[model samples]
Target: MLGEERASATRIRLLRDVGMLFESADVGWLLSERGAATSPSLDELYRGLVRALTDLAALPPCETDSGDLPASAYARVPDVAREVCDVLRVLLGRLAGAEAQAASSPASARAVVRALAAPLCVFAATHVQEQPWSSPESRSAASQLLEAAVRASGSVSVAEFLCGGTPSGEQPGALSAVLRLLRPQMTKESWKRNQATKFVFSWILTRVGRPWLADHLDHVFASSLLISDDYRTENKVLGVKCLQHIVVNVPAADLRQYNRAQVLYHALYNHLYTPEAQLVEVVLPCLLDLLSVLEKPCGSTEMTRRTNRYDQVLRLVLTHMEMEYKLALRRVYARNLAVFAHRMGVVMIRHLKRLERVIVGYLEVSDSPGEQSRLSILDVLEVVLQNTWPRVQSRLGALVRALLKLMCDVTADSGLCSPVAREELLDKATRCLLLLDRYSEGQIRA
Candidate 1:
C-alpha cells in the first residue's frame, strides 16, 4: 500500500510537470523531438505521460473565488482535452477486445463495463462544451465510447450518466451530450437513405421508445426541429417508422397514451413545406399516409375534436403552400393574394360553400410549372381535392381559372420544360378556358 501510494504521487507530479511543459513547449522543438525519439522505452514513457496528462485533465477544475479560471488556464484545456481523448481512443480499443472476450462471463463483463463508465462520461461531460474538442470527429469518437460503455453495462445508468438525468426534465447538458453522440450516426450524409432509415428506426424502437424517454417528447421534437435538413429528413422517416412499429406491436389503447397522432402532425407540419428536395420526397408519402388515417369519420365527440385538429393542421398546411407559391412566383404581392385566397376558401368551405370550391381554387392557382412552390402546393391541393371532391364544385370556376393562369405562366418559362410539354400545358389551359365559357353560360340560366 505504501509503495502504491508513492507511485500514485510520482504519477501526479509527472502529470503536473507535463502540463506545465505543454503550456510552454515550442511547437517546432516538440515536433522535432517527437520525430527523433527512437528508443522503445522512451516511447513508452511518452505514452505514459500522455495517459497521466489525460487523467489530470479529467479532474474537475479547481474552484477559485476569483471567478472563472484565467484565460491561460482555459487555453491549455484544448491540448489537455486532445491528450485525454487520444488516451481514451487507445483505452477503448483495448476495452473492445477485453469486452469481446468477457462477453460470455456476465459478472466479469459488468465489472469491466462499470469501470469504463466514469472516464467515458467524465470525458464527454467535460469537453462537450469546449469548442475545439467539439469537432465532429472528436464528438463522434466520444459518443462511440459512451455508447460502447452503455451497451456493455446493459443498464440505463450509463445513459443517465451521459445524459445527466432521465429525459423527464429540462436537463439540456445530458440531452445534448447523448444527442451529439447519436446525431452523427443518423445524419443523412453519413448513411445511405436505406441505411439511415434502418438506423433511426432501430434507435427509436430500442432507445427513444421507452416510457421514460417518451415523457420528453417535446425535447425530442425540439431537437428534431433544430437538426439540419439532412437530419430532419432522417428524423421524420424515423418517426414514421416508430409510428408503424407502435401501431403493429402495441394495442391502440396503449398507443393512444403516446398521443402519436399529435406527434405525427407536428413532424408533418415541419417537413411538408421544407425546401430540401430529398426531404420533400421522403415526407410527402408519410403525409399521405397520415391523411388517410385521419380521413375516417370520428364516432365520438372526443375523437371528433382530435379530428378537428387535423383540419386545423390541413388549413395551416394549405396556407403555407400558398405562401410558398407567392414567394416563388415573385409576383407583385402575390403572397398577400394567395393568403387572401386561402382564407377565402377556408371561410367559404367552413361556412357557406361546398368543399369543391376550395379544391378548385387550390388546383387553379397551385399548378404553375414555373413556380417550384406551386408544385408542392399542387400536391397538397390534389390530395385535398381527391379526398373532398364533389364538395368543391361550387368554387370550381375560380379554382380552374387560377390553375390555368399558373399553367400558362409555367409553360411560358423556357427553362421549365420541353416545347412539347409547353404545348400540352397550353392545350390544358385552352380546355380550362372552354370550361369557364360553358360555366359562365350556365350561370345566365340561373
Candidate 2:
C-alpha cells in the first residue's frame, strides 16, 4: 500500500511538471530569458523542463481542435518544437552518462535511444508538414529528426520509409500513420523530383532496403531513363556518384546481389562520354578512383582471378576516357585540352600515336599571344613526355623542335607572358632537353 501511494505521488508530480512546461507563458518566458542565468540548479531545471516537453511532444496524435488554442499557444508551438529538438540533439552525449550511472550493462542505452527516436521523428514530421511554418528553420529541424531516425534504425529501414514502404518486421499501421503525417509537406517540383529520388538510391546502396530496391530496379531505371536530357546530366552525375559510394562502402557480397551492377556501370560510362553531356569536374576524378578500387589485383591463388566484374568496369572506364580524349582534341577548345590530357594520361599512354598527333596539331596553331592557351598546350606535352617517354622519345625529333621553338618565342616575348607561363615554359624546356640527350645516347648505343 505504501509503494502504491509513492507511485501515485510520482505520477502526479510528472503530470504537474508537464503542464507547467507546456504552458504558453512559461515556454515564451523561457525563450526570452536566454543569457540571464548561470546557476547549475537553474540549468538542471531547464533540462527537466525540456524533458517533460519532449514527452508531451511524443504523445500519439489525439483528436483535439488545435483551432481552439489561443493565438499565443499556437505561436509557442514552434518554439517548443525547436527546444525539444535541441534537447534530443544531445542524446548521444547523454548516453555516456546513462552508461556510467546504470548498474546493469550499457546496452540499455541503445534501447533508450531507440525508444526516443520514433517519437522524435513523429513530432518533427508533424511540424515539418505544418503549413504555417515552412521556413528554413522548420525544414532543418525536420531533416535533423529524420537523419537521427535513420542513424538509429539503420539505413535499410530509413530507405524503406523514404520510398513509401516499411521494413519487414515493423507494424504496417504504425508506418502508414507516420507516412500520412509527412505526406502533406513532401511536395516535389518536376525538376526536383528526380534529384530527390537519389535519397532512395542512396538508402538502397547503404543496404537499407536492398530487397525492395532489387524488386523495383526496373522502375528506378525506367524513371532515370525518362529524365529529360537537360536534367540527365545532373541526375546521371548524381547517380554515378551514388554508385561509387555503394561500390566502395558496401560489401562486395551485398553489391553482387543486384544483377544490374554491370548495367549501372554501362549507364555511367555512356553518359560520361555522350557527345552533348557537360561533364562536371568532380565526376572524372571520382570515376578514376572507382576504377582504381575495382582494379586492385586479387590474391595469387588460382581461384582468385584478378579479372572480375570490377575489372570489366575498369576496362570500360579506360575505353571511355580514351574516346573522350580523342573527341575533346578534335572538337573542344584548345584551352580545355590540357585538362583532358592531364585527366586522361592513363588512356593517352595506351594510344600514344593518336594522342601525339593531336598534341602536335594543337601546338602548330597555338600562335595566339594568350598565355593561358600556350601554357595549357605545353602542360599536355609535358604530361605526355613524362608518362609516355619511350613512345614520345621515338618521335622526339619533331616534338622537341616544336617545344624549343615555343620556348624561344616565350623567352623573346617575355613581356607577353605571365610569371606562371614563364615558369611552365622553363620547366618543360629543361625536361625536354634532358630527354633529347638521353634518346640520342640510346640511339648511338643501339
Candidate 3:
C-alpha cells in the first residue's frame, strides 16, 4: 500500500498494477496475496479488485471454455475472480457492520458506506454476469451484497454510481446484465417482505431509462409485475411507478409483443378495485398513458373490439366514483375523470348517463373548504359540454340544477371557502352555466 503522503494517482496506479497481476496469476499466488500480512488498505483493495474484475469481464470466453473444460485450465482463469469475491465478501461485511452502528454515528457511518459503495457496486456489476459468478449461488451472494450496499448508500447514490459512469453508454449490454443478478432479490416474496429490495428494484427501473431497458424488457416487466402483485400498498405504488416508466420509455411495439401490453392492462385495471386512495391516484394517470400505447384509434382493429380500453377504464373509474364516499378519493377520481373525459373525445357520449350522475353527485357534496372535488367535476362538465354539446341538451335540466345548487352551496358556506376560493368556485360554476346556456340555445332557465 502507498504511504498516506504518496500522491493518490501513484497509489491508484499501484493498486491497479496489483489488480492486473490477478488477471494472470495462479491460485497459489492469489491465495498467498489473500493471506499476506501486508495486504492493501480497504480503498486500495477495492480499487484493485474492481480493476481486475473489469478486465476479466471484458474478456470473451474461449470457444472451448465449457463447464466440461479440464479442471486445470478453468481454475487458472476463474480463481482470480474467486479471490476477488472473497475480498469483497469481507468488505460487504464491514459495510453491514458500519450500518449497524448508524444510530450512534449516522454521519460517520454513512460516510464510510458511501465511500466504499460505488466501487464495490461497480465490481459487482462488472463480473456478476461473467462466468463463475453467474451461477446461482454466486449471483445470490452478489445480489445480497448489492442490497446491503445500496441500503447503506441510499438508492440515489448507488443508482448514479451504476448508471452515470462512462461505461454505461459504451457497454449498455454489460449494464443490463446487472439486472439478471438482481432478479432473485426482486421476487414477489422479496418485494413484499423487504422494503429496501422493492426500492432498489423500483429505482433501477426508472434510473436506467429507455436505452438499457429496451433490450431487457423481460426483467423489467417481471420485476414490475411482482411489485404490483404484492399485497403491500407501498410495493404496489412502486410497481405502478415502475410500470409508468416502462410504458413511457419502452418502445410501444415491444410492449405490445406477445400480449405484454394486455398483461399490463389487466394488472392496472384490477387495481381500480382497490380502496386505497394512494394507489388509485397513481394508477389512473399511468393507465391513461398506457391506454394510448395499448390501443390505436381511427378504424384500427382495436376499435372493432366490443369494448375498447378507454371505455373499460372509464366504466371502472365511474363505478368507483359512484360507490366512493371519501372526499380525498373523490377529489382524485374527479380530477382524473376530467382527463378521461377529454381523452375519450366525442366517444365520451357513450358513458353520459353514468358520467352525468357522478358529475352531479360530486358537485352536491362539499370536499374541503377549497372545493377541489366540485371544481374538478365542473371541469369535467365543461369538457362534456365541449365535446358532446348536442347530446348534453337532454341532460341540461339535471346539469343546470346541480350547477345552481353548487353555486348556492359555495355562497352559503362562506366560512368553508376562503373568499378567493369561494369566488373561484362561483366563477367556474357560472362558466359551466354559460356553456350550458350556449348548448341549450337560451332554452334553459337560470
Candidate 4:
C-alpha cells in the first residue's frame, strides 16, 4: 500500500511539471507571436525545453512489462531510461512550429536552432542507428521529430534541425555520404513514408556539403517516381525542385568531373513527356536550367552525350506537337529548342534536319495546327538561321516548297482559320522565307 502511494505521488509530480513546462512554453509562444502580456522569454522556454529533453535522455530504458507510465522513465526512479524518450515525444510534437518563433527572438534564435539540431542528432544517433537505445518509444519519437521537421520547417530550419547550420559550399565532408538511411526497406513504423523520407533525405544529402549529390543521384531520382499517394503530383514537384536546386547550386569545383550531370539531365528530361500537365510544367524549367548549366569545356564523352540529350529534347517537342491538346506545352518545348540551337549552333541543327517533314506537315493546309505551334516552329527556324545558315543544309527544294505552300495557304481566300492565326502564320513564314537564299532563286514569295 505504501509503494502504491509513492508511485501515485511521483506520477502527480510528473504531471505537475509537464503542465507547468507546457504552460510556460505556451505563454512564450503567445508572446513571440503577439506583443508581450507578461509571457516568458522564448530563450527561457527553449532552455527549459532543452533541460527537459536532456533529463529525459538520461532516463532508464523502458521495459516491456512495465506499466504504460513506467517508473524507469520517471527521473531518479529504478531505470530512469525512458525519461528522455517520454520528454522527446511530448516536447518535439509541441515544438512543431516553435522554430518559427525564433525569428522574433533573434538574440536567442540562432542558439536555439543550434541546440535543437546538435542534440537532436545525438539523440537520433542513439535511437536511429542500427544498435540504438533499447527503448522502442525513444526510436519512435526520434523518427517523429525527423518527419515533423520535414513537414513543419523550411529547408534551412530543417537543416539546422539536423546539421546545426545550413550546408556550406565547401567540399563534401567525409561524412557526407549517407549509409544509415540507405536501407532497402525502411521500417515504416520506424521511418517516414517514402515521399517524405526521399524528399527530406535528399535535402539532407545535398546540405551535407558540395558534390554530395554526385554519389546518390540515382536513389534520389528513383524516389520521385516511387509514387503511392494522393499528393503524388506534389511529391514529384518537390522532388524535381530538389534536383534543380542541387544542379544549379553545386559549386563548380564539385561538379568538375561529375559525369552524372548527364544522368540528372536525362532523368528530368524524360519526365517532360508525362501526361500530367503539372508535372510537365514543373519539368520544363528544370530541363532548361540543366541545359543552361551543362558546363562548357565538356569532354568529348560528355559533349557527345549532351548532344544526344539535346536532340532528344527537340524530338520530344516535335512528337508532342502532333497531338492537338499538347500545343500549349509544345510551344514552350520548341522555344527551349530554339535556345538549344542557338547555343549548340550547327551541330544541333544538323540533327534537326530529319524533322523538317514534321515542321512542313504543320504548315500543310490539311492540318490546321494552332498559331502557337506554327509560330513557335517558325521562331525556332528563325533561331536556326540566326545561329548559322547550313552551308550543307539538306532538302533545299523541299524546304522552299513547304515555305511557299504555307504562305499561299495562309493567304488563300478559302481561309477557314482565324484571321489572327493567318496573320501570325503569314508573318512568321515571311520572316522564315526571307532567311533562305533559295526562296529568292525559287520565286517563293513570302
Query: After superposing candidate 3, which stretches have Cα over 4 Å from the reference?
Result: 1-174, 189-194, 298-306
For candidate 3, give the lDDT of residue 244.
Answer: 90
Q: What are the models' TM-scores? A: 0.43, 0.47, 0.65, 0.49
Q: List the residue pairs that clash in candidate 4.
A: 56-83, 56-84, 57-84, 59-80, 59-81, 60-79, 60-80, 60-81, 60-82, 61-81
Per-residue lDDT over 125-236 for candidate 1, one digit per residue giving the tens place of the 0 to 100 score: 4454434324454555555655655554444554454343444554322334344444543443432322222333244333433444443444444334333223445544
lDDT of 4 by residue, 236-294 (tens): 67667666666666654443345556766766776765667667666767776676566
Better of 1 and 2 by lDDT: 2
Q: lDDT for model 2, on a 0 to 1 scale?
A: 0.48
Q: Per-residue alpha-carbon lDDT of model 2 for 1-446, expressed as tens digits?
A: 67745644564455455444444232223322346556444334444544565554332222332212233323334544554554455453344344455553345554454444434555555455533433456557666766665554444455454433444645321233333333332332332322222333333334424444443344444333333223445555555555555445544444445544445445555554554434533344444444444444332233243345434433443344344434333333334445545644544565566556655655544333444444565677667666666665577667767777777776787675576667776786666667656655655225
What is the lDDT of every predicted structure here?
0.44, 0.48, 0.68, 0.52
Model 2 residue 263 CA deviation (Å) reads 2.1
Ranking by lDDT: 3, 4, 2, 1
lDDT of 3: 0.68
lDDT value, residue 172 of candidate 1: 25
Using lDDT as the yardstick, the better of models 1 and 3 is: 3
